[model samples]
Target: MAADTAEENGDAASCSTATLSKDLADLPQDVFLLIITYLSARDSVACRSISRAWHAAFTSEDASLLLLRWHFSRSRETRALVSGWDSRSPGTGRESIAAVFAKVARRYHHLRQAKPRLIEKIDVVQEATHRDLHRGVAPWDRILRWNDNKAIFQYSDPTWCMDDGLLIYPGLDGGQYVAYDLETQRRFHVPFDNADKTVRRVRLACGVLVIEWCERAPYHQLNEREVVHRTFATAYDVQRAQSRSSSSRSAKLAIVRSPSDDSSAWTIVFRSEWKIHFLGLPLNATDRFFSTHNGTHYALYIWQPHRSPWGDDDPIEQLAVWNISFPSAYRPSLDPAGTKRPDADLGPSVIQRLTWRELEIIGLRQRHTPAIRELAMDENNLYVHEEEHRWLAGTQSSIFPPRHHTVRCTGFPLVGIGPIWYDECCADGDVHMSFCPRSGSTAGLSFADADAEAEAEAAGNRAPTPLPLTSYRKSTWPGYAPCWRHEEFPYLTVSDMKDALAGVRVVARQCFMVEALSVFVMPRISIEADEDADADTENPEARFADEMWTELMGKGRIYGDERWVVGEDAEGRITIVRF
Candidate 1:
C-alpha cells in the first residue's frame, strides 16, 4: 500500500464529481446504481455532498466495492480482505471501485504538498531497433491504431451468409444464424435446414446453409510438395433433413418459385472435386499468396522461394509470381496442365484474374536477404521500411534482427502466379534500408497499490481495516503473444545481427524465448510411441528416436496440422521453418 495523507489543507478539486440534476432529484436506488456503473469514481465522489441519503447510499459496502474495481482494477490487499470474508454472507469488507477512488484521492491531496517530479529514463544501447518517435512512455498501441482507428474489431465469426453483405456465424449446438443490425435496431434469425443436431457442420453458400464438414485435404508427399484437392460436396438450394446418412450425401439445388411444403422443391446442382499438383516443396517456400476474382475468371500471385533448394541458411535471392486463373468449372483450360479432365467442361477457362489496376503496388523486395517486418500497399513509391540493429549496421551483417522494412512497386512485366496465389513478377530486387521497433523489455503493470495513509484519512472515513505487505502474484509472460508476433522475425539484438548469423549459420540453428500462456496446450500424446520393438532392430517407435529427441531438446512443441519445411539453399545452409 502507498502512504497517503489528506489533512485539513486538502483541495476540493481532488474529490469526485458524480452528480444528479433536477431530473434525478429523487435519486431512486436504481438510478444511483446506473450512476455508479457509468460514472467515473472522481465524478461519483462529488455526488456525496448532495444529501445525507445519497452519502449513506453511495457509502454502502456494495457501492464502494464496485467503485473500487472500476478505479484500480485489482488490489491485492483488497482481494485478500475480500477472500477472508465469510462465504455464506458478505463480510464487512468495504473495498471496491468506490474505495479505490477515495483512497487515491486522498493520496493526491497529500502529494500536493510535496513536489512530484517527472523523470525520463534514457536507454543508451549500441544497436539499432524500430523507430522510436515518441519517448518510451508513449502508448505503444498507437502503432496498430494508425489514423486513430480502432485496432481491435469485434464481430460474429465470419463465414456463413443468409442475406447479402452481413453474414451469420453458425451456432455450435444446432443454433440458428442470427442477423443483427445495430443501426436500425432490427434482428433476424435463420433456421437450420435440418433439425438433426448430428448433422451440425455447414458450409456457407451465397445466402444459404450448405450443411457439411470441411473436405479432407491430401497430405504432402514425402518430398513436401504443394497439393491442391478439390471439394467433393455437391451443392443445393435446400436440403431436407433425411434420417439416413449414406443416402443423403448428395445436396438438393432446385429453386421453388412459389412457396410449397414439398421437400423436392430443391434440386442438386453439381459435385465438386479438384485435382493434385505440387507447389513449392518444403525446399521452395511460398513467400506470399494473393488472388483476384474477375467477372468470369480469377488471377493469383505467389511470392515464392527464389534459389535452388540446397542449403539451410540461404535466403531467397529474388521475388517471383506465377500466373493462373479459375474460370467456370466447365473450362478445360483450368486444369493443372491445361489437359482435359473428366470435369473440365465445368471449370474456368481464362487465367490472370487481376488487371493492372487492382494490384497497383507489388514490387517490394530487399537485396536477396533482409528479414521483412511490415508491408502496406499504397500509390507512388512502394515503401520498403526496414529496421536493423545499430550494431549490425556497421561491422557485422545480420540475417535477422530487431528490424522493420518496407518496399515499393514500379512498372514491370509481371504475371499471375497460381490459383489463390499471386506471383506477378519473377525477379530479384535491390537492397534497401529502414528501421524497426525498439528491443526494450516492455511490461504493463496491471495491479495498483492502495494509498494507505491518505485513504485512512480521506473524507474522515476510517479504513475500518488495515492492509498487508506483499499483495499480488508475479507476471508470467514478458514478450508479445507468439501468435501476434512475426514468429520468424527477431525482437532483441543485444548482440550484433551479423554475429548471430555467423554463430547460427550452421545447420539446425534454434532460438527460444519465454512465452506467457493463458492456457498451456499439452503436446499431442498421439506421437507414435513404442510398438513391440524388434529387439534386434530397435524400439519400433525408437527407430528415429535420436533425431526427434534432438529437435525436441530445446524447441517449444507446436502442433495443429504441423509440417516442417527444411529448405537447403545453394550454400548448403538449411533453413527449417515449421507452420
Candidate 2:
C-alpha cells in the first residue's frame, strides 16, 4: 500500500509538468510577440515558418518590421537575401530598428535615382600613331604578336595598361622589364636579374611594384622528396621613377622611394626569399597592395601546407597582410636561429593574417577550402573574392575529387577580420572602387538632401532647418562629428552622363579575355585614420566578433564604381564590367 501511494504521487507530478508546457505553448498572441520581438531577423523569419499559427501570428504590421518587409519584398530570393544579410550582423531586436529604416531609405534613393545604364560601348582600337614600327600597316597588331620568331622585337606578354596612363611589360628574356609612359612618350628598360632566376609574375599598387622571381631546385632521379620552389620579392617605387625623366627610358640600378612620401624616387625595399615545398601542381600565388587611411597593406594569397591529424600534408590556403612601409623581421636573415621575437615591432604594416577559422563560427573544421582570387582595399574597407570549393562526391579515399567553385564578395571592417558585409553574385571575379566627383561636376550635394537645404539657404529662408534623424543624414549633418575624420565628399552620383563620367561603369563583352588589372586614385586617397579608429590595438583576427556590428555602421554602402577592362587577342577589343 505504501509503494502504490508513492507511485501515484510521481505520476501526478509528471502530468502537471506536461499540462504546464502545453499552456505555455498556447500563450496569447500579444504575450508571444513580446518574446519573439527579441529574436534575430533570420531567426524571426525561421520561427514564423514553423507552423500555420506562427505564420499567421507574425505579420509586417509591426512598425519595427516594416524595413525587413521592404527588403524581403524587393528580393524574394531567400538565398540571395540571406547571403547579403550575413555579410554584417543586424543587431538583435530593437537595436536594429534604426538601421533597418536607414537601409530602406537608401534602397529607395538607389532605386529612384541611381538607375545604372550603359552610356557608350566604344571599341578599343589600336591605331598606328607611331610610324617607326610600321611605315604603312598598323604595327600594334604585329608588334604585340612579335615572339621568338621575330627575334629583333620579340614581345609575347600582353601589355598591362594601368589607370595612371602607364604601360608595363615583362620582356621575353634576361630580366628585361619595360615601362612605357604614354604621357611623356618615353620607354624604360630595367634589367631586374636575380642569379638567373626568372620573374614569374608582378603586381603594382599604390606606388609599389612587387616583382616575384621563382626558380625550381634541380631534381634528383632517385630522390623521393617533393619539389622545392624558391621565390623572392623586390618592391620598387614606380610613381617616383615615372616623374624622374621625360625623355628616355634609361636602365637604372635602384630608385630610392619612401612609402611615406610619393615624391621620393623608386627605391629597393629589400628582398626576401620564400621557401616552401610544392605539390605536383604548379604553385600559384596572387598578391595586391593597397593604402588604407592608416598605412599601406599588402595581401599575399598563397596555398600553404597544413599538417592534418593523421600526419598528412593537407593544403591550406591563406591571405596574409603585411605592412609594406616597414621591413619584415620574420625574414630568415633577421632571425637566423629560428627563434620567435616576442617584442618585435610588427607595426601597422604586414602584421595581420585573417583566417576563415577566426571569422566563421565553425572554426577550422570547415570542409571546404576557399580560393582567394584577389585583395582590394579602400580608405575604409578591405575586400576579397573568396571562392569556396566542394567535392562532388563523398569518399574515404585519399585521391582528390572533382569540385565546384562558389565565389563570394567578402568585405572586412577597416580595422579587423570580422566581416562588415558580404554579397553573392554569379560572376567570376569581384572588385571595389570609389570616386570623388571632379570639382563642380554636378549641383552641390547632388546625391544628398543637403542640396535642398542649400537651395533653401540661398533663398534666405535659413531657419536653421533641423537635420533628419535618419542615419544617412546624421552621418553628414552639419556640425555632426564622427569617430574618424570623414572625407569631404564620400558618396557617388551616377544619374546623368556627367555623373557617369565623374564615376565609372563596367560592362562584360563575352569575347575578350582579361589579361591585366589595376586601380588608381586621383590626387591620392588619404591613409590617415581618425583618433578613435586608431585606438583599437588588437590583432585583426583576435578581435571579438561582436565588434563587427559596432565597426560597420552602414552595410552594403559603397562609393563610386569598379570597372574591369578585359583585352581580346583576335579583334583587339576590350570589355568593361562594372561592380
Candidate 3:
C-alpha cells in the first residue's frame, strides 16, 4: 500500500515538472488557443494527439476553433479547385476538376450533417461555385478594379484586348502601351517617343506585342506630309522572382528588354514595311496574324470578302504559313506540336524575324457558301463561322435552311489531330482541312423501286427530299450536361486559342444568350495494366489518347479563365469581371 502511494506521488511530481519546465504554464491559455486556431483542420486534428490542453482548446465551441479550422479547410479547397483543371501535365496533387469537386462536396456534406451553424461560411463559398452552372457570375464574387488610370484611353470607353493570358492597350495618356500578364501578374509599359503619333491598332500573339500606328509628320515639310503607317513588334522577357515561397502574393515579374534597340528597352522582333497610299486601302492589308509558338509556328491570315455575287473563280479563304524566328530571350515553351518543351531552343539571339510562305486555299470551302462571319485559328485547327440551314419539306418556308449563328472547325474529321497537330504540322509539310458530310432529301433513301414507290404514293405524288446529316460536331463536348444552353460561336479568347494548340482539350460550347461559360473537365483515360505485352502489336489507345473528349464536370469555370471584362458603372467606377 505504501509503495502504490509513493508511485502515485512521483507521477504527480513528473507531470508538474514537465508542464513548468517548458515555460508552457507561463503562457496564457488564450494565446495557445489562438496559435492553434491559425492551423489547418488537418494540423489542428493532429494537435489533439499532442497534449490534453490542445485537445480541450480545440474541442471548445466558445473558442470557435472549429470555425477557424473549417475556414482554413475551405481556403485549401479553393486552391484545389483552381489547380484541378485538365492541364494534361501531372504533379498537381489532384487529377481532374470532377475529382476535386467530389472530394470537397463529400467533405462539406459531412460537415453540414455534424455542425449546422459552423458550416454557414462554407455554404456561402459553395454558393459562389454552384450558384449558376449555366450562368457564370463574375469571377470570384468581387469585381477586379484597374487602379492604373494612366492605361485608360477615354474615361467613357476603354480600348484594350485580352488574349492568351495577356491584356494589352494604349495607356490613358496616349503614346504609352501597357501589357499585363494574367498568369504571372506582371505589368509592362512601352512609351512612344513622339506623342503626336496616333495609335491605329494593337495585337498580342504568342507573347509578342505588335503595335501599328500612323506617324504624324510636320505639315510644313512637303516630302514628309503623308502619315506613314508602321508596325513595331516587340518581345518581352518576364523573369519570375525566385522566392515563390511567399504564400499571399504571386511571383512578381521583372520585364527585361533585350540589348539591341535604340528607341526603347524592348527587343524589336519585326517592323512593318513602310507604305504610302493616298486612299485608305493599301496593298499590304494584313489585318491579323496567328501564332502559337513563341519562335516557331506562325500563320498570316488575309481577309478577302466576296467581290462579285455570282462569281466563284477566286477562293474566298486564303491561309499562308510564316516562319517566326525568336531570339534566345523569348523562347516560348509551347512547341508547334502542342507539347510544352520548355527547354527547346530559345533561338540564337533576342532579335526575331518573320518570313512568309504563300499557299492557296483548296479542298476546304464548298461553292456558293455564305460569306465567312468570323475567323479563329490555332496551331492545330481553324474555326470558321458559317450560316446554319434547317430545311423541312413538309412545312411551308421550312424548305430553306436557317441562316444564322453556325460555325465549324476545320480539323474535326481527323481523330487525334485537334490536340496534337502542332507537333504534326511541324513534322510534315502538309496542311489538311476537315470535310463536312452531306445530308438532306436524297440522303439514306435508296431510289430502288419498292420503298421508293411506297414513299411516293404516301406523299401524294410529291416525294419529300431527305434531310442531310449536317449537324454541328457534338463530340467536341462529350459529357456536357443537356440542361446547359449551347452557343454556336462563343468568343474564343487568346488564352483559349493558345491552350487548344498546346493540347489542353476542351469541348467549348458557349451557351447562347445567357453567355454560359461551361468548362469541361476531361479525365485522363486509364490504360489497363494487365494487357498482353506483344512488342509487335500496336497500341490502339495511344491513337485516341490525345483526342479531345470532354467529361462532364459540374457547372463551373475552369481555372485559367482569368481574363477581365472591363466596363464603367453608374458611379464612374470601372467594373471589371476577372473570370
Candidate 4:
C-alpha cells in the first residue's frame, strides 16, 4: 500500500510540473489580450520576440488597436485618424491596422527618444535682398527689427510660427511672407500691399494664420509731433489658401509658376485694430506681447510695466488680456474699393490689469515681495514665475555673490473679463516654492538642488546648503490648473528654454552655452509610475527624460510639433528634424 501511494504521488508531481511549464502562447486569446493590457506599449512590442505564437497574438488587429487606445489616446488627431481604419479590409494594397499602429508607435518612440530619421535644412534667405544678404541680415534679424530691435522676451511674439506642417516666416522685403509646406515641399507667398506696415508677430494655428503688424498712423492731435503707432491683427484662412494654390498650380502646369500664382491664395477673413498704449503710456519695446488660439477662440496677452501710484521706483506690472473671434461669422468685404467701415475695436473694451500688489492680495502671501522673472501663456492660463531674494546672515551688506532666493509659480485663469476666483480652502494651493543658493543667476536652477535643499531644511538641520557652480502647484477654478507639471525637470527658465505643448507631450528645447541646444520631449504624466514617488527610483519619467534628451548643434528659436523639431543651425538656416 505504501509503494502504491508513492507511485501516485510521483505521477501527480509530474502532472503539476507539466501544468506549470505550459507555454504562455497556449493561453486563450481573451486572456492573452488581458495580460497585454497590463504591459506598457514598449513591453507589449518587445513581447513579440518571445515566440511565434506570441508574435502572432501581439501583431493581431485587436491588440494593435488596444495598445493605441491605451498608450496614445491623448492625441485627438491620432484617435480620429485611427477610428476609420479597418484592419480586416485595409483595401487592395494598403497596410493593415497593425502595421499602421506599429509605424505610428515607432514614430512616437523616436520622438520620445529625440532620435530623428531625417534632418532637412532650408535657406529662408531666398527672398532676402542682395544688400541685406551681403550684410549678413537673415530673416530672424528682420523679425527683431520689426519688433523695434527689442530682445525677444519669452512672452514676446515669436520670431516665426510653425503648425500643421506649415512654416511661416518673414520675407526679405517685409512686405511679403512665405508659407512653406513641409509635406508638399511647396512655397506659398502671402503678400500685403501696405508699405508702411511691418509684420511684428505671426501665429499659425487651427488652419488660420494671424499676423500682428504695426503701422504708422497720424497723431490724433495735429499739434503732436510724435508719430502714432497703431497695431492691427489680421486673420487669413490657411487651408483655403493652400487649396487655392494647389488648384491654381495644377491648372497652370504649362505656365511657369510665379509668386503671383499664389498671391491670391490668402484670403483676409477677419481684421481688427488694437490699441497701442495703456494709461497714457505708449507700449514700448520693454512691453511683452503674445497671442494663442484654440481653433475657435483667439487670445492675446500683453505685459506692460507701469509706475506705481505711490511714486515708488519699482514699476508695477500690468497684464492685459484680449479675446477675439478667430473667424468672424459675418464676413464683410474690406477690399480697398469695397465698403470700408471704421476699424472695429472688437474687444479690449475692458482691460483687466493685475498688479503685483493685487497678486499678493489674491494669493501669494510672502514675507518679502517677489519680482516676476518669466511669463508664459497657453490657450487656457498664464504662467508667472516670481523670485524673492534674501541676504545671508553675515552678508547682508554685501552687494554680490551671496544671497538666498526663493522661487514660486502662480497661474491666473484666462477668462474673458471678470473677477478672478480661487479656492478658499487652498487659496495658494497651486503655489510651489523652492530655495536656490545662488542669487541673480538667470541660467536656471535644477530641481535636484531644490529637492536636496528641501530635505536638508526638513531634517531640522540649519547648516548652510552647499552651492555648486551649476545653478543652472495645483489650483481649482474650473479649467484653471497649472499650465505644466513635469517630474524630471520643473521650473524651466524662459530665457534658455523654449517649450510648446504638443498634444500629450511638452517639447522643451534648452540652450546650453557649450552644447548649443538640447531637446527634451516629456510626457505630461507617466503611465507606469506614481507621481508622488521618489524620482531617484526606477521611475519611467526620469528614465525617459534622461534617455530621450538629445543635444543638437544650433542656436536659434526652437519650435516643434508631435513629430518634428524645427530650429536654426549655427549657420542661421532653418533646420527641420523629422522623426
Off by over 4 Å in 2: 1-163, 173-175, 218-225, 241-295, 304-314, 327-350, 354-356, 359-371, 379-381, 387-407, 413-420, 424-501, 504-506, 511-579
In terms of lDDT, model 3 sits at: 0.29
For model 2, residues 428-486, the per-residue Cα lDDT tens digits are 21123212122222222123444675577478652223223341332222121111111
TM-scores for the candidates: 0.25, 0.38, 0.36, 0.52
Which stretches of candidate 3 lie above 4 Å from their native place? Answer: 1-158, 163-166, 181-186, 191-201, 212-294, 305-317, 327-361, 364-406, 411-575
lDDT of 1 by residue, 1-579 (tens): 122334322433334233323434357766666566555455567777788877777766556655554333223223333344212111122234444456544432222221112211111111012111101111111121223332221111112322221223333333444443211223344443322221212333332333322112333443344442221111223222122111121111111011122221222232232221133222111333322221222223333334456744333333222211222333221344545564444443232233223433342343333433322222211112223322133112354533232221233333434222122111111122112232111111111233553355365542223223232221112112111122122322111001110011111212123122111101111011113322123111101112322332221221111112122222212223221
What's the TM for model 2?
0.38
Better of 1 and 4 by lDDT: 4
Off by over 4 Å in 4: 1-60, 67-78, 81-95, 125-157, 163-166, 171-175, 180-195, 205-208, 216-228, 237-268, 271-323, 326-557
- Report lDDT (Cα) of residue 110, candidate 3: 31
Task: Report the candidate with higher lDDT, 1 versus 2.
Answer: 2
Q: Residues 210-313, candidate 3, lDDT per residue (tens digit)?
A: 44333333222212322223322233332222211212212111111121222212222332122111112211222222222233333333333334556546
Better of 3 and 4 by TM-score: 4
lDDT per residue (tens digit) for residues 1-579 in model 4: 999999999999999999888877678777766777667566777888899988888877667656665555433223333333222111122234455556556666765554677778765442124222211101111111112322211232334567766788655554356777664466677644446554566678776676765544332441233332455556666663332222342222211122233322434343433443332223244344444544444554444433345644543444555555423433221332325433345432323455557655656432222244444455566555443323211211123411333344556666644344332111112115332222112112223354675576468543222223242211111232222211112222222222222222323322121111233332322122223544233212112233223322233345655656676655546777776
Between the candidate structures 1 and 4, which one is better when assessed by TM-score? 4
Q: How many backbone clashes can be found in candidate 4?
A: 3
Estimate the overall C-alpha local distance difference test score of candidate 4: 0.44
Candidate 4: residue 135 lDDT (0-100): 16
Candidate order by lDDT, decreasing, is: 4, 2, 3, 1
